[model samples]
Target: MFLQITGYMTLIGLTLYLGLRPVSGRYFVDMATYYNYFQNYSLGAHVTSSKDVVFHYFMKFSSHFMTAHGFFLLMDIIYIYPLYLFSKKYFKQYWYYSFLVLIVSFSFYSYGTNGIRNGAATSLFVLGLCFPENKIKTGICFITAALFHKSLTLPIGAYLLTLMYNNPKTYLIAWLAAIPVSLVAGSVFVSLFSSLGFDDRLAGYLTGQGNLDVPVYTGFRWDFIFYSSFAVFAGWYFIIKKGFHDTFYFKILNIYLICNAFWILVIRAPFSNRFAYLSWFLMGIVIMYPILKQPLFKNHQLFISKIITVYFLFTFLMYFVYYN
Candidate 1:
């Protein structure tokens, strides 16, 4: 009964938070384009030679704006259920607390509004993380995500590497080492993407085109950084003290942190803020599992949780009332 209440409360809270925002209707535009492109499969063949027949079929069948948006919403909801199952199975003791932490985090809002493929892909990746031992099943999940967005190839490739490494320490060390390389290679990566036939328009948007002084709502806020750092520390404590041994999730979290840290140093744009969502999403699992199981910081936990909740509420209200 408590679980049911929490779940409904979460759904209501998310709905109220997201529903009140002015729908820019950007997703509708993208969906329409996708639908049109799929409808012209021969044109799709001319555009890209890979078989995305399933994606094409879905778009073809669900051509209307309402149907497309409904599909997107359904995918978003479906993606989170596996996360719930994973949280319950592994961190049963702290599932509610963890869910609350995730709900209060602004990552959910950012992803929902972004209307980009990466956001959807990340959700599916989380679902994949929930089932580590089932490699074949996990591969299918990763492949499905790639169909939604190819950038996920990075994390999916990292998952495969994690399978190769017998020790988490090795994976961590390698990830740390790769951070500097990735930062330096970002320009090369951009060029490579351009050469590989990705739309320059899309690439420019992702990397942030020439600076325009715009009212940025999200980015590397000092507050977000502080909270993320605390969450990372909490994860470290949990793993070391409780011997949390989910190597796949740990590898994903470590890579995410390293990449975000590198991005913070190298990139400067509100668009870069997407990395925070990835960071916080994984951190939710890392931080909450420990807190749920031990409750060692019971008094401090509740106090901090309440403070965080109030802060999010204030920000949400302020954004709607003043910023909007």
Candidate 2:
């Protein structure tokens, strides 16, 4: 009991420290975007889109009693809650290990700093995933998440796809379909969304006209596919061979596959990294839970834990190194 309290306190304290730190050097542009938006919001600038309007007003409301940093700090803190709830409910005995996974994934600090809105929404999506049986609540969380950041709509769609198709073939199909989708349907895809009233700013971002790094349909990126493919195969192992097909584990694996598929399909879209996080945020669980379930790795689990710890320690260090 004492240990648990200490553990949670340590986690919370560390998260708070990271959250309160100034924006890292690497995310200067992302920070600028948020700062600009917040400033505009405070000045009552007209936010054109529903999503931007919503975020703007929320920030405006928050800035009344607190500084902008305070709002960011709050988002950073709130982001961890869903992760905590996930561990408490699903991981149970292995919750500590799960938390370690999350830390190493850089999901918290990276997203907290670079994509505050998405980070907060992803946290809620994770909490919603904790209740796979509660479809209505999960749907609410998913939709709410997308409203916060448009990229999340893909994950929500992916989740819906998982519900319809539970077979292995869908995974293969998603991967294969990405090639044609990105190559041929790229412009059509953008046009379709534009027709559906995707915000002009978002469209600009998608086309790399809004200071975004990558343009839509910028041809295939082997690097993303290489790394992401590993996650897809890992999901396959857990879902099929590990016999988690009917469990929440399968649900996570399914979500990962579908999100990865979307990421692959739109590998060149501006802000495409969002799709990666949609799945990667939950990857700690998809990877950790199965290994914990296996008996042979029980003793070595301690070694595995240490390795994961070291990896994240390296990650934390790299955040400063790369950013600096």
Candidate 3:
């Protein structure tokens, strides 16, 4: 009990410290965008997203009571709270591993620092996963998340499709189809988005007209493919070899597969990588859970844990030092 309390408190302290400090260097685009939005709201500039309008006005109203840092602090709390809840409930058997998973998920930090709304949205999505038995509640959470960030449509939409045909073969077919889809995804995306009356910024992204300062999408990212290949194999091993097909880990693996399919198909589309984060963020858990459960590593869990911690910490520190 004391150990659990200490761990939770440490989580809170770390979140507070990181959330308060603004990200620096090349990753400053989204922060700059937020500041621009704040200024625009202050000047009564017309914005397209009513959700953004509400968020902007809320921040404006909040300014009367707190500084900009306070707003970020609140958002940061909202973002992490659901994640903490999900880890506690689902990963209760391996609580420390849950903590390590959160610590190692760099994408979570990227979303939190770059697009806070998406961070909060993904966190809510995590809660939806936690309550999988409650379909209505889960649906409501997913819709609410979409209201915050439309980019969620890719992952959420594909996940819905998975609900229809959940066989591994279906996912495999989708993955195979991605190569052909890559040829036309960019054009089709632009046309469809334009017809749907998407916002200028998003439309520009699809049409390749805007410079949103996001990473340029080169086709067939080797790094993503490498990680994705491992995820696919790990997922298959857990489901087929270990008989964990009906488990939550299997569900996450499937989601990762779907996300990977979309990524492979539309590799050149701007901000397409965001779709993968829906599943990629859960990679730590999917990989760790099965390995930790295996009898071969039971005796060396602590040693393995320490090594994992050191590697992730080194990567995290290097990211901040070099990228920031």
Candidate 4:
């Protein structure tokens, strides 16, 4: 009980720290953009951003009463609070383990600060998954997430598809096949994805035209792909090899595979990390869910502690080494 309280308070404190960060683009990619937009909207500027219609109006309305820093606090609340709720819903008293996994995930800090909208939407997506039996609640969460960031369509669509067909083996096979396919015909997938017209920015990513101002990896990222493969391996190991069976795990694993497979096919695109995040956001739950639920290892507590250390170490390394 004490640890849980401590964890929750710590996460709450983190939300505040991130939200109130001094507005700058040095590392927080979208922080300055959000600040400028909020200032303009506060001055009675029109909210013309239709891509995420609801989110734009949200900012327009929020700016009327609060400074940009206050708005960031609100958004950070939206982004981080849901992790607590979702972990509580699933893990109960043991929720701290899941919460710790999520906060330390490689993309967690960056998403909370830089990809603010995506962070907010993905948090909603995780929360929505918590109440699968309640269609009304789930639908509302999913819809709101989409409005916050339309890129959520991929995962939400994958969830709907999972309802229709929940087959992990097939998805795993396809996910594996995507590597060689991507190596040989990555351009084909790019053209096909751009044709879908999900977002105009898809084209920019495909043509390496996105973020000319922001330097990012455009070529094949074998290291990143290798990093992402951990969830795939973990899922298959628990479900197929060890014969773990749970409806919720099935749903989560399938969605992770489907979404990660799409990223695999487009792994060479510019800002592909953004695409990878659609799946990476769920990596914590995907890998830790089964382990926490069933004692996969003999010394479960020690195992979890070690896993937490290794997981957070990835973020630590990225922050200091790669990000530097």
Model 1 TM-score on a 0 to 1 scale: 0.67
| Backbone clashes, candidate 4 | 0
Alpha-carbon runs more than 4 Å astray in model 3: 1-6, 22-27, 39-54, 57-64, 176-198, 289-324
Better candidate by lDDT, 1 or 4: 4
Query: For this target, which candidate reaches the highest lDDT against the unseen true structure?
Result: 4
How large an RMSD does model 2 have? 3.9
Ranking by TM-score: 4, 2, 3, 1
lDDT of 1 by residue, 185-294 (tens): 65554445445654443354345662323345433345555555665565555566657666544675565555445444423344545444545556566555544555
Could you tally the backbone clashes for each prediction? 1, 0, 0, 0
Score each candidate by Cα lDDT.
Answer: 0.55, 0.68, 0.65, 0.87
lDDT of 2 by residue, 1-324 (tens): 754776598678867875687754454447666776666766666566566455566777776677767777787776777887787787676676777677667455667777678788888788778777788898888777776777777677777776787675466567667767777776666455545666666666555566553324455666556646655666666566656544556667777777777666556666666556777787677667666555434477675676577657755764677434
Q: Candidate 2's C-alpha lDDT?
A: 0.68
Query: What are the RMSD figures for all models against the true structure?
Result: 5.8, 3.9, 4.0, 1.4
The residue pairs in collision within model 2 are none
Clashing pairs in 4: none
TM-score versus the correct structure, for each prediction: 0.67, 0.80, 0.79, 0.96
Write candidate 4's Cα lDDT for 153-225 as tens digits. Answer: 9899999999999988888898899899999998788778877765666567666776534576766788888
